[model samples]
Target: MPALPRPAAGPGSRYTARASTTRPRPARHTDVAALSRHLTTRDLWLARMLHEHRVLTTHQVASLAYTSLRSAQRRLRTLHQHAVLDSFRPLTQTGSAPEHYTLGPAGAAVLAAHAGCDLADLGWRPSHTGRIAYSPSLGHDLGVNELLARLAARSRTTPEAGLPVWLSERSCARRWGDIVRPDAYAHWRDGDQTLPFFLEYDTGSQPLSRVEAKLAGYAAFTTATSTRPALLVHTRTASRDQALRRRLAAPARELSLNIATSSADFTTSSPWGPWWSPLGPGDTRRTTLTSLAARWTPLGSAADLEPTDADTALTLPVPPLPPTPDAGT
Candidate 1:
């Protein structure tokens, strides 16, 4: 039998009726049902991370959410397809970069449900996620999240280490914008002790002078808050580190700011080790996290940050603090 050739121009044809190339997002009720049935505890964690951090890459998702890249990819793809997640791939000079995931419509609904709030309360707009790709600070934003992620990863591996309290740029801006918009705010605690710090992360894409400009704000904030937190400066290159140190010298002395500079390092034992160079005169050896308070007396007490629970808390890997801080590679 000859193939049917009389189906052209049919008004009621099912297959040829301007076949929709776009996949429509699921309805709210459909998404909620799917969430209840298909979502896992880890999936919820991943959504929280995306919601808090704004974005995360495949490798970052793997490190923070899954035990392996294959698992992360498989799960992420499924989530992306099912409208439980959304992603965008940025173009790089070398090629394209890893797709960055943010909260999707369904994911926002899921988060809101989990938090027992309305979708609007999640503070999520699809436009926000879409606009991130075009933002000038996209690299800087991802870099900030990456730094925190690395710290969170370290905390998970090192039992003695304590997870830090992370506040996003928006949160920092909301909390203390009068002082200076910090890249982020973090408080690291070991047992009962907590030492909060202001984070100034540079991706090496901006000029060193810009970094110098931000220090004055931190200095002023420290002066006003009566809280001298370690202003940890994480940069991409050693040159940037040195330049930053030199630039910070005046502020450190004049404002009595406890500043430390270190090259952005994600390797094991790098951040907690003596990679931090205190930005001041006399015995400028690299210092550890706990030693920062001692080196800079204004940064409160060192005894508070030491893990003194004397329990197995230091013997096992624990989840990062403040619930969910974002991460990206």
Candidate 2:
């Protein structure tokens, strides 16, 4: 049989068989339920993009889906046709023609469903999530942007006029020791001069040291070469406002930093009564300065005047002190 004539290999047959024999195992951890979650063909594509990329622009989706721009437009139009994704058409910066698409409520839900998870579980928290700071990825000066809008609105009717604002984060660890980049900031410039205002919405338990350092930076920044004001805005009830105002109000006469408290807008009444503090009994009470002013009168008739020493001093409910010879005199 001539050694049975070694079997000649078929053309590409051995290679093809070898390649076909080793099938890849399906992804084990994948929830089979996800396949059923997609709504339509368009929803399937959108879900794929969101799952793969975490986010996707309409242009990117068009490219990924290998569809025409018009098709992509129709896709976005359809998915959001009933405000499905909670789609919102926000204006672009100034005159920019291209508008950016962001995930809205419905889109978020669809994407989350596809991923078999909630966004909040993926590190996005609800309500006031701490404070906003420089997100290196976002790149834009979100803090400065917020500040500009506020300052523009605040001084929209003020006579002092608008000033060009300059804003920068500390950008270094050493500077972080003495400064904090609050959620937002504002800068005003009037002719070869500029002033910076930092906004802090303290909904967290920030260390006192950090707060003081921020105020110090603001004061230092405002002092040289220009006379201007640095304002810190807070919820009216925020203890931060109280602590900061007390420090800035006394002895630091040169500081341009001012803490304003009100019941409107972001403001709320203080949680504690006018007199409450852990720093000691009197610490939380109205300042002695305010107490003195509130207690004093024009030395009018004795009947018109209540007891000064007794009234001025915040007393715990107890016995009244005996009048002293010189005190009465």
Candidate 3:
């Protein structure tokens, strides 16, 4: 996890430009209805994904949706052309950064129409792409997406495994913000075993104490809602992971919160593999994400997963993988 490059100062810096000149964006007046005709089911799904996740890099998009990088690039470029998606490349010290994408105006329109809601209700504006492009939390957002994308990709080849449900931070906030603000919420399935957990993507920027304090909120959330989902804290380094496990162990146990900690070093190859270590007394050995459920047999089913009065079909979490017919594209 290399440090993200800081945005250069001045009006003319690369950070100021939202899109590259090589692939120009469509006009602001692009008709959403006409563009909708050309969008495949997969394209519509991608638009929904971008709307939910805030942002994803080209590589991450490929991992989640396409069979190859070349094919992903091709379709993504076309989406950009139709203003179904918007993109930006960050200023990097060495090589160029991969194109990062967000929902475009047409995309929002399509999504709103699908949900049978007004465009304003979707909470999107012309400045959405630019705002996310320059957001301070951009790296954290991308890291979260990257980890989930890897798990989703693994499910493509492994028949027994799948990431059936993935809720972005915004969705998590909507459902449980009053209790605990998790980075994301997901349901990881390996055969008959399903592990529902809330993710905390730590960049190792905040103080360890502040991070430890988050456990109290999770405890309150569990007590208030009568749901005990596992808390997974993923840090940037092995050292940071060790520090977190040490700090969170006692508090997590006292609160009866099933917590686990993992770092980027061990998860790079296979995030679903044996990288997660449970925070408790004995057998500090790491375990796979799916196998984690067995370690904590008392861990019950996830609560608050059902749709509330506020949810519409369009706003609900979509399956991480696209429909089988269009996945290869």
Candidate 4:
């Protein structure tokens, strides 16, 4: 890391100028020449995450990537000044919320160079990004990312259970076309069992009928294929989970599609724990990610999956909510 110049000493230091008498010269920010050297591996990783997820709250980024809010803020401010990151805070009923961050030109350029690809292929388009601040799907988008972040955090601690693969919606589109748009696709690892599944996250803004309509497509897609990964539905509340489970069981059995349902508000428990239940009212026994193969028998015969040990990491600990950020423009 390059050494940062020290601040001026006392009230009348050389680095400081009395605003009334003299205009302070903005100390030269990191120039384009030093950008690649200035960015650490962690910095690149942060930019990659921002690119993949699109929008993330300061609190979310800080919690996931930094040890403290102060450090995250310091780096973010520097990155912003260098045009490496762009941010905007949304207006809310209670004043405003934590500012969100996205990849800026400098950061995107660096990623493009590292990947040996053009900015377009790297998913950088400021024109497209500018319109996301007020998009109606913003809440739902962040909600899906929140679930993935939690899973990522859990994977770090519970090696026995890992998220080996996670594909964004855009990537899923390229892989599966418009047949069925899952919010994300993942391969979850539990001991020896590997479960490939699709995630459908609901933000409580849609009607139950609309959600059921999506399941109909999933059922059709599964029925048309020989090997089908399980479908996991995560809702905002337990009540919604129960309702969706009942609705899903009919199609899953009728079409023989494997499915599991859970609520994102399982506040006190780790999502990796037995937070999921197979789609049936009669069998309400909680199941783990790895055990889904066993719980939903169809998933096993779909491939060479074998019965693995129980997900020993039951009750994954949910971290405290990310620290709030200061007011931003």
Best by lDDT: 3
What TM-score should be assigned to candidate 3? 0.91
Worst 10 residues of 2 by lDDT: 320-329
lDDT of 2 by residue, 1-329 (tens): 01111113321112221111131222332232443343454454444333222233444444334335555554454343222221222235785322223343444444455455665633333221111221232223332323233333233234243423322232112122243445444444333334344455443255645555666665554443233343444433445556655654542344434433221123212211122121221233332112222222221110111234433111111111111111100
Q: In candidate 4, residue 305 scores what lDDT?
A: 28
Clashes of 1: 0
Q: Write the per-residue lDDT of candidate 4 for residues 1-329, one digit (tens) a residue.
A: 44223224421223221221132223553454477776655666667667666777766777566667766666665565565676767668985577677787777887777766677877678664566787898888888777766665555466576665666776566545557788987777777777878898877777877887887777666666656788888888999888787766776677666678888767224677788888753476777877776565556222222223521111111222222223221
The 10-residue segment of model 1 with minimum total lDDT is 11-20
Residues 1-329, candidate 3, lDDT per residue (tens digit)?
11112214321122232344465543464576666666678888888888889898989888888878877776776666666777889899997798898998888899998888898999999899899988999999989999988888888789789788899999888878888899999878898888888999999999999998999999998788777788889999999999988888889889888888899999986999999999886677899988897777666545677777877966678778776546433
Model 4: pairs clashing at backbone N, Cα or C within 3 Å: 270-316
Count clashing residue pairs per candidate.
Answer: 0, 7, 0, 1
Instruction: Write out the backbone clash pairs for model 3.
Output: none
Give candidate 2 misplaced runs (Cα > 4 Å): 1-182, 187-196, 224-227, 236-240, 251-329
lDDT of 1 at 82: 56
Which pairs of residues clash in candidate 2, taking residues 3 or more apart in a chain or in different chains?
Answer: 85-107, 163-188, 163-189, 164-188, 164-189, 165-187, 165-188
- What are the TM-scores, per candidate, against the unseen true structure? 0.75, 0.29, 0.91, 0.74
C-alpha lDDT score of every prediction, in listed order? 0.64, 0.34, 0.81, 0.64
How do these models rank on lDDT, best leading?
3, 4, 1, 2
Order of models, best TM-score first:
3, 1, 4, 2
lDDT of 1 by residue, 1-329 (tens): 11111112221112211111232333443447555566665666667677767888887777655556765675676566556677777778995587688887788888777667777867888686678777888888888777767666666556455545666776566456777787877766544445567788877777867777787887677667666677888887787778878877886778767777788653233466678788776667887766765555545521123334542221112234424432320
> What ranges in model 1 sit over 4 Å off?
1-29, 114-118, 189-195, 204-210, 265-269, 297-329
lDDT head-to-head 2 vs 4, winner: 4
TM-score-better candidate, 2 vs 4: 4
Q: What is the lDDT of residue 329 in candidate 2?
A: 8
